[model samples]
Target: MRCLENRVPPPLLMVIIGLAMAPAITPQLPYAAPWQWLLCALLVLAGGVVVSLALRAFVQHKTTVNPLQPARATSLVSSGIFARSRNPMYLAMVCFLTAWAVLGGWQWQWLGPMLFAAYIQRFQIAPEERAMLQLFGRDYQEYTAAVPRWWRWRTK
Candidate 1:
């Protein structure tokens, strides 16, 4: 969440909440799409949420409520979920975007996921990683060398 620090404007959070609620707002859409697509979206959403939350709880235990700034972290998380993906929460957001697109039967919503990934990579993630690498040194280097940027095909 270092990327989420003070950099996240108040209005942006509100906008994110609203954008994220896009699927829920369109109640008619949940009944849309083929069942297979809906099921796939559900599974993806559930898995992503579970994995990401577990990783955050287990590895990033320290709360960074104000994560936008470059500051020293209370802990250097390198085990559990951190060992897998450096940006699981961001990946989870992508999963949510994909799921919402499918669940809403808005194929155009697929753009949501792609756009989210690009935006996060450019704005939040890349910077946080550079900071992390600088803070954690060779430890972070080794982790990055081993972990996939967006997935864990090599792990499980």
Candidate 2:
């Protein structure tokens, strides 16, 4: 398990999980309604926006966006979409997977996003955080303290 950390690319993992969802391993749910298709489209669009923003931020900051080489990052991006979620790219992937599951209307398909999240949290994010802490030290610590790894809704 430890050997698997930062080993598999996230996009590859996502594709593998998506492929797994194609088979009817569990009971299938009812077909999606027209409204569900609309919702799926919205989710896919949102995911694209998030990932694009995250990549743009990295580019603007001149930081490495390569997930496998967190230690090589030259900047700590904590603005724009980064301020909202530390792992916006991963969040975007989740949104995409969620949209797929919803559009497919399979009971087990919903697990794709959950499994992706869990795997990313343990294998990818943890390692990246460790590298960020090592590289950015207190600045990274303060940023983490102020921002959630994922987005949170404000409770009024």
Candidate 3:
């Protein structure tokens, strides 16, 4: 399982999971209407914006955005969208998968997003956080204490 850490990209994993879940969901679910499609489009757009904001923050901080190498990050970004979620990229992928599920009108499609979150938490975010804790030390610790693993309006 350790070998799976950061090996498969989150976006690819989302797509694969989304595709795999769709067939099981679609046949058993109702068809989406125009309003649902519109909502799905909005969700995809929002997801894209979330990812873009995170990437821009990384670029501005001159930190490595590469998911495979958390040790290579030059800085700990805690401003902008990073202040809201430690893993906006992963959150964005979750949003995208959710939107895809909505587009298909899959009543049981919540599993796709749930599975993605579970996989990311175990294989991706956990390893990345460990690496960040090692690389950034106290600063990253404080940031984690302030921000969340995923988006939340208030700290808990």
Best by TM-score: 2
Encode model 2's per-residue lDDT on 21-138: one tens digit a residue.
8665323335567887798899999999999999999999998988987999999999888888999999999998888888776577788999999999999999999999999999
Error of 2 at 105 (Å): 1.9
- Report lDDT (CA) for all predictions: 0.62, 0.88, 0.87
**Model 2, residue 104: displacement in angstroms?**
2.0
Against the true structure, candidate 3 has what lDDT?
0.87
Candidate 2: deviation at residue 5, Å? 0.7
TM-score of 2: 0.92
Kindly list the per-residue Cα lDDT of model 3 for residues 1-156, writing each as its tens digit. 899998988878988998888786666445667887788799899899999999999999999988988889888888899989999999889888888777765467788899999999999999999999998899999998888899879645
lDDT of 2: 0.88
The residue pairs found clashing in candidate 2 are none
- Per-candidate Cα RMSD to the true structure, in Å, reads 4.6, 2.7, 2.4
